[model samples]
Target: MSQENLELLGQSIAPGESRTVDFSMAKLYTTTKVEIPIIIERALEPGPTVLLTAGIHGDEINGVEIVRQLIARKMNKPKAGTVISIPILNIFGFLNAERAFPDGRDLNRSFPGTKTGSLASRVAYHFTKEILPKADYCMDFHTGGASRFNAAQVRIVAGDKQLLELAKVFQAPFTVYSGNIRKSFRSTCEKLGVPILLYEGGKSLESHKQIVKTGVDGVCRVLDSLGMLQDQFVKPPLTESGVLIEKSRWVRAQRSGLLHVKIKCNKLVQKGEFLATITDPYGTMRFKVLAPNDGYIINVNHAPIVHQGDAIFHISTQAGSI
Candidate 1:
């Protein structure tokens, strides 16, 4: 590829070249400049360009670690296509160890934003304008929000054959056909004709070694499937074929109290099975939490204290449930 044909941030990268670009964003209160870090790897041959982004919700660290390890291991040295790695997309939130930007807006929900919009919106605007247009396939990595632990899973929009095939190739133990949320990055990308996958695992602000490994391996597998990586670089099978889930629901707390969860993520539960118990501080009052249907536990809230109607467990029902 000629330098003129490959450009990002007004810079050209020839084939078989790799470069790191820092795109400037808003400044900190202390006048420190914050930039989004991007690593671009252009292969010697022409193929699809795959974009891998993590830390959109800053506290989700598993994807950050996965991207770090991926870059360290030279996984970006694709044999046939380009790999754009944005390890941390929300610098402000990352710095503060929070989920949203410093302005308290969710970056993931600020897609297709305006230039004169909020901080999150401006960041999203730049990403949408500069980075996303280059992607043929995209994967956004994430973890469960605060106090929740999720089993490794890939979420895709339903009825997209190409995305479903790619999700199957990822083999993340669970593939959720989730509906689109307005302004979400995935929805915006879909509207722009880019096939995107969202990988969720572990929990915010903490690294689960196994989950990180799974993410790294799954990424390589997807690249291999896309012909971006060489066969030799493809990962060994880390899991059996993932279950494609069409329906899921969160089991909520019945009453406010201290919660004791009896089940773990990835475990199968029968209908009406014992899942948890809520007890008062004095243990004078107790309420049993039971599975609403036969399904697999995909996520669990780790917080001991719960309020009435709080989501406690995320269950992916069997195919029949749909």
Candidate 2:
């Protein structure tokens, strides 16, 4: 039998249907309404409901691009299940080109919020209560905060074999073991028993082609594993099951100066490998930043200049091929 009609935001959409629901909340100072577009697609056959979301950080344009491509290419139209894509969750921050809500709160850190909380908290409360409960599986996209460009990877809390297997199926370049932060979306998903794979790539405000492709391809692999990918798309080939980073640490700059990086994000480096150089703008003194240990360069700082203690590189302390 076909799946029951999906209900969201007080609207009912039956099987083999497509709908776009506008989630409206607080308006701008000018009283203009801002709506978050939630696109839903369902198949004739019954299967799992997968939720795809991006732009939670607002400045993470690469994540936004990834979801946008999935919709534009018709990838969200599943074969046997339902797909709901929310390309930009924090429309307020996206509109202002800021990282946090207008009230200066990170929407991600305000999950399961109070009914009368701040604007960000209210958005979180409604989403956690209304929308999140309907999802069988969830995928959230993100990027490095500012100048740090992260390698394409799926992050999951360690020790969950189910989530680990799902990450393997997504097949990003790396599978990172990260603990869920309190009040964060990943933690909320865990609390609600919804499996989530959090993807991080590139950096905020910049959309890289390769990073977007990796994200889109990873989504395809995950959907195909669940038997939800459309027939028009081919299943992605399996590569390395993806490297597992058990532990990681940042390589910090020892001196403040103009920075020049020499290695790519996913490259493996030796302990003493020359990774980058921090030099005085006037060419007086220079300091070489070497790898702290032998591991993959999973994140690189793309800033033109750095402070004495700024993190310049994220190197894996312990990693093994899965």
Among these predictions, the greatest TM-score belongs to: 2
Q: Which ranges of candidate 2 are over 4 A from the true structure?
A: none
Model 1 lDDT-worst window of ten: 1-10
Candidate 2 accuracy as TM-score = 0.98
Clashes of each: 0, 0
Candidate 2 — number of clashing residue pairs? 0
Task: Write candidate 2's Cα lDDT for 218-300 as tens digits.
Answer: 99999999999988899878876689998999999999999999998999999999999999989898899999899999999
Cα lDDT computed for each candidate against the true fold: 0.88, 0.93
Give residue 63's lDDT in candidate 1 (0 to 100): 90
In the range 155-240, model 1's lDDT, one tens digit per residue, is 99889999888887777888898988899999999999999989999999999999998888888888888777765575757555
Q: What lDDT is reached at residue 68 by model 2? A: 98
